[model samples]
Target: MTLTFAAPTPDAIPLHVIDQSNCDAWLAGQGEQVSQWANRNGFTGAAGQTVLIPGSEGSVVMALAGFGTADTRARKRFVLAAAAAALPKGTYKITSGLTGRALEIECFGWLMTGHTFDRYRTQSPSTALLVAPAGIDAKRVEVQANAEALIRDLINTPAQDMGPDALQQATEALATEFGATCKTVLGDDLLSENFPMIHAVGRAAEKAPRLIELNWGTSGPKLTLVGKGVCFDTGGLDLKPAAGMLLMKKDMGGSANVLGLARMIMALNLPLQLRVLIPAVENSVAGNAFRPGDILTSRKGLSVEVNNTDAEGRLVLADALTLADEGNPDLIISMATLTGAARVAVGPDLAPFYTDEETHAAALFKAATEVADPVWRLPFHTPYEAMIEPAYADLDNAPSGGFAGSITAALFLRRFVTQTPYMHFDIYGWQPVAASARPKGGVGQGPRALLEALPDMLDL
Candidate 1:
């Protein structure tokens, strides 16, 4: 999957957009030669209609795509993606007057439509080439697209193959690619290393649990990413209903997204030391599985009482965040499919991020708006910290009363991240329904906005 953006040649075919009301006016303004060819071919630009005008040199002169009434028209950003997918492999420019965010987002759609996760498949499309708009960076688009694709692919894979060990392998592979240092503490080693909570949550699974670490770059600001890699969350001893367990394979979507963001950082060669910590585990139910009423100690030495084994994502993330905080990174960002409260607040398309740092939140908001990735800011609410307090332990993994579950979860993670500027994103990484650019499957949330905002956040 390599894409190239080069300057378009004079003979490059134009992608013309035609609205229903302005079709005649647009065709009237065309060159006499092009107009005659269009007329002879009966090219009337009706909404969702397409026509190719042939040139005298046996090449396509232009492609006309129709739009419906302006008021009634579908507001799909990637309406032209299907068209792009059908185009021959060549550098192309949208001559449809798209600019600013519209142009950037549409180009992103074009690039994404060209993505095919054929890692174990027999057939895949050749990368589609498109000439980037003037002042737009092709490398940036490629980085974002690659990151999103990686996140989607990882989340879409089943638990059978994408368990903790496989996650370590993926981390090691990325480390090798970027010349980063990689290490892991597996199974009982997690207990020896003081990641008892992580080990306890995953000890019952056949595929052993591990904490994966990757370090890259040097001599700059430090940025750490912590992800909850609950490889297959079956709700442990508490147990989820059959419906709730259906999408448990994607419970590690946060880990996938963090790895995706890490890929972008390494690919762009950002001027910052990067560390990724993933507490990869499978929350399975067995005789040995950690249960409710159990008290576990985390890497930070904080005691956590498990009230509901279903709330396991935060347990793994707590350990990873504690390890990341040990390095005292300038900023720490953690992503997890940690709560249903987030989805109830902002739905699946919008991820909600919690940060005490206003400047970082502003940067993320701006980047999300610019990229159309869409994230809303949720409050840390220091007062809510009391909600997670336990009578017998330092904290309760599951807060009582269930009010502000997402905020309380953020507060729990905040306790583990002391020195660094910390932010937590509670994301629903699966799109329940299909839309313009987002298909109805594993979706990458927050990584795009995070990747776009990082260079500026780190002052690179």
Candidate 2:
């Protein structure tokens, strides 16, 4: 929660952004002593390089941050985070080599660099702070940073303390903050409420399974967000190996990102009525756990056959998505960490999304690039729709042959979302390696691009 940006002050350090294109010109302008300093330090304006300049009295006066070439910038994100890591404790201002969208994204990136999940252990506080850049909404960036922190914190927490009840508590607290109406259908009530699939997947666990719904905004288009909130996945009866279970605590990544997006929508007061539906549960093994070959009816009345208990995310999301569709919202978006096939297709860095609408695809891709939140478009592929339709039920939670796993998963959820423009994001929410501002723990995907593309997607 530390402030990552400082207001403009007289003595803020000058941070010049030099790239390979202008490195020599910048060096020549600084004269011999600085030129020698640059050479001795091997400062070639590479992406992570930095140089400190000294004044006549031998006191530090300014700093140089390397921006590299266009290709270099394309290969990475949050480049200024390197400067944030390199610079000593102080305030700084960008003096050259960035403007417009790049500047705005970097400003937000700089703030994200200050985030660290320290709930379990003590961590050092962030040292460097940047002056909020000119000609952009500083408050917007701060709000987004806070929302991002909330997502990471929720996802990073251990499943031991972050079960279904805890997830509901988090949602309730968030609803209270924004004056939204929040409710949860608990335990046997889930069965009474017709969220049978959600209840079936979670009934084995000690913590009760429930559907959590939050409503906000009094006017504008109705936008429903459905997130798969499997707080922890033991992979049910088809259990995962030790390695697979290591990151199971992050199985609820969808809910975390949904909350982050919900926070942003309410904080920004967007022109949309937002409804968030999260089926909070823990997929655990017990004598009564739902098993393979079991058929469960969803809230949409679609019967789903459990082919693999490991594929539980889509089951929980199916019921929640059905409830969302009953509201007949303008747009239906579902986020889930549902398949390893997605990870194999696009790797961990890119978020692969599926939508039948071309306009949504175009707007989301454009906004993703503009915001440096990378997303790839996967197809709904009606040709493969048969994969999810089993003879035993309306849908199969996991299809045979392991072909088009991500697409079939999307197809399964799409059945419940009958009358809305839908977008399904198959996200690998854990960062395998630390990047610019994002750490190696749980992270968010697709929501930032969704936020930026909302206006055009909904024609607002």
Which has the greatest lDDT? 2
Deviation of model 1 at 353, angstroms: 0.3
TM-scores for the candidates: 0.90, 0.98
- In candidate 1, what are the lDDT values of residues 184-284, reduced to their tens digit? 99989988888888899999999999999999998789999998899998899888999999999899999999999999889999889999999999999
lDDT of 2: 0.89
In candidate 2, position 438 carries an lDDT of 86
Residue-by-residue lDDT tens digits, candidate 2, 1-460: 7434797898898888888778988899889988888889998898878888888998778888888788988888988787777778888998887899999888888888888899989876557789987887888788888888898899999999899999999999999999999999999999888889889999999999999999999899999998889999999999999899999888999999999999989999998999999999999999999999999888887788899999999999988887888898999988988899999999998999999999889999999998888999998989998888899888899999989989888888888887888999999888899888888898888778888999999887
* Candidate achieving the largest TM-score: 2
* Stretches > 4 Å off in candidate 2: 2-4
RMSD of 2: 1.3
